[model samples]
Target: VRTVVDLGGVTFMDSSGLGAIIATYRSAQDSNGWIRIAAPTEPVLRVMQIIGLDTIIDCYPSSEQALNAAEQ
Candidate 1:
């Protein structure tokens, strides 16, 4: 399964939130699935970048793009 997390509606997130995303990412990896972020808010983007997840995980401006990437 390919999961697209739409961050467009997310206004805020903290360390715990980041942890959850990482955990979910691992779960997907283990299950041979995938997860992607879509349209992350500026604050969330900063945190993701700081954690270096931006380099490992695919982030797209829209869910459509993420899903397309997943297919490839």
Candidate 2:
């Protein structure tokens, strides 16, 4: 269940959204899978960085990079 979440169009994100991603991450982990975030808007990326979510999940500058990494 490798996942690449494309956030290019997402301009905003709050705790709830973050929580959902966390939950999904946990679920993926439980299944020996992984999740990655890609192309998050600056503000959203800042929020993630402030919360240290960037350390928990890999982030990429583009969805193609994320998906490509998943393949590897």
TM-score of each: 0.90, 0.95
Model 1 steric clash total: 0
Encode model 2's per-residue lDDT on 9-72: one tens digit a residue: 9999989999999999999999999999999999999999999999999999999999899889
- For candidate 1, give the lDDT: 0.88
Candidate 1 lDDT over 1-72, as tens digits, reads 458899998888888888888888998999999899999989889989988999878899998888888889
What C-alpha lDDT, on a 0 to 100 scale, does residue 31 get in candidate 2?
Answer: 97
Error of 1 at 22 (Å): 0.5
Off by over 4 Å in 1: none
